[model samples]
Target: MSSAKRILLTTISASPRENVNYQFNNQVAIASQAPVALIKLLPIHELPDKVIILCTQKLYDEQYETVRNLLLEYYDQILCNTLNQRPDVTEVRIPDGRTVEELWQILEAVLHSIPHNCELTLDVTHGYRSFPFLYFTAALFLKALRGVQIKAVYYAMLESEETEKPIIDLSLLLDMVEWFYATRIFHHTGQASPLCELLRPLETPPAGVTGKDNAPYQLVKSIRRALENVSAAYAQALPLELGREAEQLLRRITQPIPRHMEQKVPLATELFGSISSFAGSFALPATRQRRIRIKEVELNLSELTRQSSIIDSYLKQGYVNYALGMIREWMVSCAMWNQMAEESIYRVDWWIGHKRFETEHKFAVLARTAYKADGNTTRDIITPEQRWLASKWQFFSDKRNQLAHHGFRYEYVLHSPQQIDEIRAQWEELKSFVSSKPHWNLEIKRGQGTLLLSPLGLSKGLLFSALHHIRPDEVFVVTSEESAISIEEITNRADWSGRKYVYKMKEPFTGFAEAKTISRELQNYILKSDRIIANITGGTTAMQYVIQQVTQDLRLTGIETEIIAIVDRRTPAEQVETPYVPGEIIYIEGQGRLNPPPND
Candidate 1:
């Protein structure tokens, strides 16, 4: 029993263009081959049982009246005349095409009208510029949020220059979006499974590139092999083996393609490029060998994420020894590298500073001292809860060291599962503690503190407000290459102690791809942070968007993060009569606050 009902959704246009007139004059046969265009273009099996027209009041009454009459005529006389009934034609009222809020409302109304078990077909034949985009996004939203199956999305190809009227299937765009997401999964996990699944989609490349001898076709096949090799390398933690295969694959990618096939390939080129960029990092030197003191020579955010992901894969597959060592190394790096920068001063003695710290324990002690001295009181910086977490991490480190130096004992290898599980659980708790809000003290000041400012949009308010809320130990101002001057000035003007480090983004943080890249650049700083407070009030929309996403991603890994937009509200007349009362500060936590403080 097929429960699918076909519903056609389209907007009515006010303009009396050639395509509109052509559509109206010929209700049954817009083309010579078929009597009815909608019936001919849409798959016969998926033809609409109901037609929905979205139109503004002005267009519905004046312009859409003619189109509606034509549809009604076709339905009553041509489509269902022999059946003795007319197909349902629903006219959904929409606001005049101007605001995005109006567009959202229109989408909601269309969604509300849709039946539970139905297949959707959208028509972009005659509509405004934003119509197709809005409708497409709505379809995606529905598919994700409501489990709606989008059978097809259509846009009739009728440019003024083109003589033939053809229907263009827009469903392929959504498929490409899915492919991008799949590739992103592969990039993040370094697992060949997701990329291998993409082969099914690439078998039918966009623009009909079905040539077996095509360079892109061959490239994708080669990439599948490369992914397999890289996956194996990750499984074994053999960087050399991965680098050998990756560099060879990269060589094949950069090698001159056939002149004829270059222009024909669109989707394949993008897929290959993304894969190449992700794979290129595997060729880099080991994290241990990389310079921690030199800012530019450090392992980037993406590399760290990949390394962490690789460790997770090892743990999942029961590579307990390898996972433990990697975890210990990363934890040490997080501590010592954090001490390398002044703004990130937390544990190391600010007075004594970093002195080629050989052991992770010494680094921890120094970090503790810095945190203790951050305030006026001589009280311990770490809470008892935090001390417990530290103790657990130390235990994990001890076990890792025993395995490394004394070789694997019976207990280490025999009861590995229980030990690994404990280590993993404690590692998560330690990470949460390290990045939790409790480790970070909130400093209230009028101006000046350690600021992680992004000066993309040339705004100083965010920096000032952020400093006022939390007076950091050191400031790290981040800026795009384009806005480096602006961030430099802010860094110089601010009366923060010690060196002012400015990190530059290679590109604009506008899209998902760019955001991922930007997130990598800010990883170290974010990990060192007790809290990630994203000031979306400043910077370009892209910059603000990526920061919010990065912070959210951090929160997923048990880190505390917040998004704050500074609001400059004028005091009300009645309030202005009284003495000055500053803006009220609000605090919210993932866990509810304790009703009564625990007696220590």
Candidate 2:
């Protein structure tokens, strides 16, 4: 077979808006040269069969179209001028968008259109957001093209002030790619190995062989042996000098053969060894072998506790780190909210003094310290409040922890009913408080008292008092009972003097007659007076009749009257005070005096 290779080259054109496009262009050209030189330096290279060139579509619109056209125009001239040989090339276009899904779809479409055997080259210097896409695409490509050799070129642009040359280390990147490929290969090939059979007992053992049988015991040993071999081989292939370290790790892991081996040979041997010693010392039936087996199983469990403790410590440390991370996230979320709500204008000194932001910074230190304390096992350290707060910040932290440590999958973390209720209550309280209307000096009183007359037009009666702050020139009194106090008596008693009085008959009248009477009475009385008082607090009909009469009179004559509602005092031998105290009413000099309560 010809030792031919496939190569992919990518170049990113800098935008005109970029601060140093000239420098970027030179860097890209240099980066482009270095990869081609590296490929030529490879020992077993017949020239590459297929080459793919990747570039941003944005570059085509902004800068590279002219360059591309020039290259096509002077293709032979460029080849003669340049040191490196140019290979057959296919251009792959990367789309522009803020969303990963959009970019992913565009990339997927582009890759789908390309021939299956071709390798991918990514140019990712423009923006950091492209890194995830590039990594994911490369990983996927490696998975799809299993046997194909892949190479990566990383470019770091240098500043003029820096004399140190920019270095691109492709070793780690290449190692990662190779590891992914190897893992895929191992996963596929491992399916056919005896290791797969060892794993099978973990899923489903043979029908006759109960879990207590020697079959499971044997399977554990077999699995441990296979895992050790694979791990040793993998370590031997590692490029690192610490193959001894890898072997040590494999040895340590292999020391604990999982107690549940398919065949119970080790367990049976231990049990029989113990029983044989006791055979001379004690009397026991042959049928008691099952009892001895049970005893052996119990002994295995006691030993497992030691192994489980090691696993638990690791798990606990992981949980602690997880919890601390959640706490840090929550603190960030709260700080962001506080900043947004307060416009970052206020509370700077408070935030600095209290160190709310600084507290979150300590998470890194605390996480590391806790991890170390828990024997580098995050699962062992329990960050109780941190985990709780993490759940508060994002409901997934606790659920994620359980899955990580406990291997639980089905249960999901969600807001508890109590948490929901508390949140709802707080929201309702805030809504009510924010939306409530302001109440001015308006006051409502509920009591029986004498109506006192004040310059503010307050009436102090035997049972109640009212302040008619709005005054009228003429007084209208419409009462059903003639025995009730007259308008003159009320006005005189309340010291409402010089106010005109108009009386109407208690009976209803014809429309025009009623209208004329109302007009004539209001015009005659109000034209000469300064205030009009209407009292209508009694039985329902009496109040209604008085209201209608006063309303018609005022509407016809355009007189604004101060109406006082009055209810009669029914209790006897007990003096009823007005609801309003005399001191509560302020009277101007010319305004009438508000009568005080009668001294008993």
Candidate 3:
């Protein structure tokens, strides 16, 4: 809300030619409504009134005086005749930008010189390797620590002499960094607030985007609005609507690798795809079909395990707040799990804010209702285990409530081994409760029905796509030693923690002979499996051919098998419209469904 971005901050470096010469040619009017000539002069219109040149000691001692003389001469001849008065330029000295700490110190000095409540327009055009990064970090720090708003970040790519250099705003790139962190938060806690914050900026189109190909701008606004709807759906306890909206947003907002310089936003696209996938696939236990329920439990258990692992990492690294947040989230999830039979699994709004039940009281009420809901009045419904669980839940509920309402005071907070044990007990209890379902145990259990054989090459998207859609009993990744390591990492990070079913072909399966040898081993595994699915999306030509041939041979021998491939159509000629980036998972029968797929 602090709108007075009066000062433009730029770094002085070796090449000061562009610093003085580069006008914002082909520039559009900024959102700030500064004059075109003024914008061309400073390049960052948000910093409308003044410019501040932050010079390191090295630059000032070596090249600052010369640059000042050149700037003064340019001002005297060209700028003086055209403008009313010379632009207010001031030089501030700082430490050398040699080390990260030194650059940070310089950044601190620069930030301290600015007023606390003013907006910032940072020009990262000319700086050393770490200078641009330091500025970005400083901008974030100032925003968090000092309540400063970063209006825009301008960079003039002064590479070619002939091509006109318009000032490009990289603010969205910086927001992508925040988006990445927000994504991690969402994955950890399943909260929509971080995602809402991410989309808030797109309420208005970015500066200078208009005319015919307004798809990006319109799509961004639509996605932002859809995310707002998702947040509302979360509040209203409508997971189905939330998932549907998120799916719609994914289709609307997704963009391919752009042809124009102005069209590229790789980070935003990646973050959007990740979050949208998470939200779209999310389901409430009561609303989902049997198969979807199995998948929901699978994804939930994996996410819980990953969150616990991250908590351990945080505690090891002495990140108390992060650990506390994770544990508190776990506690809330456990409490919610107790009330899951009431069909309240999707109602996050109840736990967060229910008009009738306050936070602390709600947990106690939920505990009683959950334990006593079974129609056995003669006998005490609450077992010894349930009693113990309820007691621990009360303790966690109190602590969690305190932490949420009050603040984190490490000295006064609880971190005993007993507390840890209770949290782990709750996690195990929830896991057991969910895993009691027949389908949940069936798909997650080792050596079950479906077997998906994927030849691992480069792209891991196909493997992930297969894993998400088809809950395969075991995933056999056929690749060399090096690629096996990479694939394992991908699978692990995808929340398949401690899963031993993802097997790598021990034999060298690169050639026809070696592939045949591996196929024999795969035959045994497939014979045990109820149904077989061959993902012919990744791997070398020889490897894919071997899989197709091997599976086909098995089918002839009366084995049930299906071959599938993932294709991401980027060109218009491929289809009427693309869905979910990777297009769609389609059945591949002979050559009809085998359009050439992207290489890994």
Weakest lDDT window of 10 consecutive positions for candidate 3 = 438-447
Q: What is the C-alpha lDDT of each candidate?
A: 0.55, 0.37, 0.55
> Which residue ranges in model 3 land beyond 4 Å of their true spot?
1-3, 13-23, 27-48, 61-86, 99-101, 125-127, 147-172, 189-194, 197-222, 229-265, 285-421, 433-600
**10 residues in a row with least lDDT, candidate 1:** 440-449
TM-score of each: 0.41, 0.28, 0.44
lDDT of candidate 1 over 297-354, digit per residue (tens)? 2433343454565566566666666777777655555444433445554433321213
- For residues 1-600, could you state the per-residue lDDT of candidate 2 as single tens digits? 534355544444453222222222224222233233223333333334444445567655664554444333333444576675555555556656458786776567545544544444433333435654564565456535654334444444333355322435343454444334443333333211333332444545456767567554564445445444444433232211112222322333334444543142234334323322221111111232433222211112222232222222222333233333333333433332333333443332332323444434333223332333333433323254333332333333343355455554566534356744443343233223221122100011112212221111122342123323222333344333342334455455444443443444444222323434543443323323344444444323533454556444443333344444443343422323432322222222223433333341
TM-score of predicted structure 3:
0.44
| TM-score, prediction 2 | 0.28
Question: What would you estimate as the lDDT of candidate 3?
Answer: 0.55
Query: Which of the predicted structures, 1 or 3, would earn the higher TM-score when compared with the native?
Result: 3
**Judged by TM-score, which candidate is best?**
3
